[model samples]
Target: MKQFYLSLIAFFTWVIGMAQSGGDSTRLPLTDSIQAKKSTFTIGAVYANDASYYGQRSDERLPYVALAAAYHHRSGFYLTGMGYRLLNDSARLASAYSLGAGFSFPLGKSFTADLSYDYSIYPKFSPFLQAANPHSVNLTIARESVVDLSISGDYAFGKTNDFFITPQISRDIDLFNIGRNDLVSFNPSLDMTAGTQHFYEYYQEEKGIRDSILGILMPPVLGGSPSEQNPTIKTTNRFEILSYNLKLPVSYNRNHLKLEVSGQFSLLSKQAQSQPGKVNSFFSAAFYYQF
Candidate 1:
């Protein structure tokens, strides 16, 4: 994981060096679309502090960096591509990567509809087991990957555009064959910046983790017996997490600086078993800058 982050940092450093030498990073991707007026290239880093176990002081910190190139055409077409990489604190932790694409088109004079898809994947690793007191081992479970697809449209009302409403439906895929989460959200936007916006989004995952993981089999080695090469462990345990998120954008400079902050809360309860879920609430903040 450390090497992964180091490599990402090295790549970005190389890009920055190229940018300093009069090479255009925006033109590096969509060479045909570099003629747009409102195009920009941005880079930013974010730090997030997460607390779990019903907020009982199980805190974790994660940091990541992102880069994006965006273009707005004279025909009202918009396109953007972004790459993000997670920095891991532990050598055994997995580093995550994400690719996002989005487009927004005018629905009317005062409204626009935006469709976006973000695909994220994490490297595979075994759970961490630390010896505690020489007699007990503490197991830290692995984080799963989720693919998020979201579609939203907003209608602006009021003369000053101070008040508006937005409705969106989104789906979350486990990607690892665990389970799927789907939900719809009704969000409202308020004007905060000069033509800038603030939004609140709320949604839920349709299925729980227990139902999702039950069909998947444990590793053959863990289930093997002395007489039988493979055996099945008999235990019925399952749980699901209900989640909600609040998203807010603080700064936007189209070229220089953009900041985003999000807070998330989740409720976990055992369905077939009587164990508590490992996670509780998480908060994340991100920033971007372009030169």
Candidate 2:
């Protein structure tokens, strides 16, 4: 059961990462050449069936909808904002919001780099797991070729600090063309993630209030002591391989609008264990429009 809760937390963290990276783990969408001539503004909306990080998946259906807006200058500087609303059994109309700024630029003929910072805001009693870490810095370096290759590093801090690294290889396949200006394509990527689990420790400590309520509903004798109710899940500060993930995204591009449906499967490592070697799957749909 504790592992189940941890899985829920991991899912939220993964979703936050996906949003921050412009729906792709390896590249920055805001830096495309289309926006190089002038500043561009984009608006997007997303819906996900469930959330997963690495191979850890939420036991319950934690569906959510999010709206985002971004501004990208021709010089490769950008600003973004997003708001989330959980469509679960919660009274809160708003779940969280994030504000971010970043810069993206080419390194050489084939390499590009992006650097960004994000700050997240959550309610005091927010149920989301990532509330523990409100600030993060991200850097990604990519090499364009027959197969796109990239590596990303993230450092998140607030109640606790955690670091993660992901290296990925991917290819984009154009399935067909729609008229002269539109097309459909499939993008497939494989990535491995390694990270520390300090945020899990913070989450464990923060569960006291909820556990207290549970204790009141069910007495200590039946529910056990607070310590027993919330037994410490030992975590190591050392970095460990969390999960290996494969992602497939199908996208339709028409004029200034893009629609995408994506799916991912993750195989968990020993470090992400409720059960060792777990597998999790997730799905989402999103649309973005630029002006």
Candidate 3:
């Protein structure tokens, strides 16, 4: 498993190198050509059938309300405060998370690099999260181009350590030029994550040791009865490919306000233990005010 993840890391690294030097003209992809404001705030909500990523996934739709405020320094240093709340079934999972800061700098004037650290909390006791655990700290390193690659690691949390290696590529097409300062664009993106099984515990009906402990504390069904059939129990920390996600985000950007509606489909690996009925797909609409 470790070897597979290491290979995944190498593969993305190679892709980044190719992106930076692959073109016949040796020109880089277009990035933010204008100088962006130093400070910005984004407030939005994501309503989806499930939260799917390389390191984690929920077979069920759990909505997230999120807010973010960030400041970028002239020296390439940036800090951000982020928070989110999970809607529905609050008794079993966590809500409102991730405070982080990072730095982004130009790499040879062709690519960009970012490094960040984050501390997050999972407020509920389930196979997926532990409220009693220490504030989880994670570090991420990223290289950006036409395709972006991020490698992150989590420490001091669950019984087994984990890493999230993701590669994301996005393309944008202008549906129409609404005006000089206003237009709508259709953005399609592909994000792939490969990591440990701990992030995908939700798909399996079986409970691990930590889940068993939580179950022991609470009744089998919350004023309900135990099932007659046996449930499957699995171990944790097994590494595997997590998901391949494709997202279509249609955004209408008019000045400082951005409105978007998107649908995401994820083809999770067979190891996810998810059935056809518990598929990973969702649609979401978001409103953001950026300044």
Candidate 4:
């Protein structure tokens, strides 16, 4: 992992150096149609502090750096996935990730809708373990003009049968002169989520945490004497607002390539706020290209 990260740093340094010298980074993979269709192939690296994306705490807190690849077409179809190396918490390169494929289409004058299925796979100790679900179908609709408005739904298929809905709004502003022919912009957005009780069940350690190691991290929450008839009841769980977050993303674009850097400041609602050692902010850096 250390060597891989060092290599990645070198790769980015070289790319940026060439771009600054007015050199081209095109790979010669496509022709005029690729440029006209706005077909893009992208790879990026992300540094995230929020290990507990489900809004829960663990005994250990570790930041993660992930590598991601994605492809998009002007026709509104995309495929994307991430591979992560867990830092401090574990020493695995492919510890956790989600892969998604989807299609998008215009709904009306300014509205567009997307449909996709996300497959989340976590091998090591991660928040997704308790839910017993890995498959989720996501749907999103939004407008991307002067102001952006989007709503999304995610339904997990598993024993937990969890579902969540999120609504968001955003705006973009032009930044100061970055490069003469390059574009710079900053996007700020806010979003809120409401979800089913099953999604939050990871918080209830007594009922969840089937793995012995995970049980140690969370600790059993339920208590009963030797004479107790039932240890834990299924009806004790309830649902509330899942989370809300404010995100700021800035980007620079030149030619058919763009480099983006962003920060996500998040706030959890209801029982989700009680997490300890949980980092509420995540940062990312990405480079994208078309044609």
> Which numbered prediction scores highest in lDDT against the true structure?
2
Give the clash count for each candidate: 0, 0, 3, 0
Question: For residues 107-220, could you state the per-residue lDDT of candidate 1 as single tens digits?
Answer: 444344444443434333211110000111111111111211222222222211212122222222111211232211111111111111111000001111222354534334
Colliding pairs, model 4: none
Global Cα RMSD, each model: 20.7, 7.6, 7.9, 11.0
Candidate lDDT scores, in order, read 0.31, 0.73, 0.52, 0.60
Model 1 TM-score?
A: 0.36
Summarize candidate 4's per-residue lDDT along 28-73 as a digit string, tens digits: 1211122245777766666766464544433345567878777778
- lDDT of each residue in 1-291, candidate 2, tens digit only: 367446545643554344322222222243463225688888899898775545455334567899988999888888999998889737777788999999888899989899999999977645555567999999999897666789999998998898989998776666678788877877777788898877766554555455565463433657678566544356548788888787889988887788899998877777762334777788899888888
C-alpha lDDT of candidate 2 relative to the true structure:
0.73
Residue 207 alpha-carbon offset, candidate 3, angstroms = 7.1
Q: Residue 181 lDDT in model 3?
A: 72
Order of candidate numbers by lDDT, starting with the best: 2, 4, 3, 1
TM-score per prediction, in order, is: 0.36, 0.82, 0.65, 0.71
- Deviation in Å, model 2, residue 19 alpha carbon: 26
Candidate 2 lowest-lDDT run of ten = 19-28
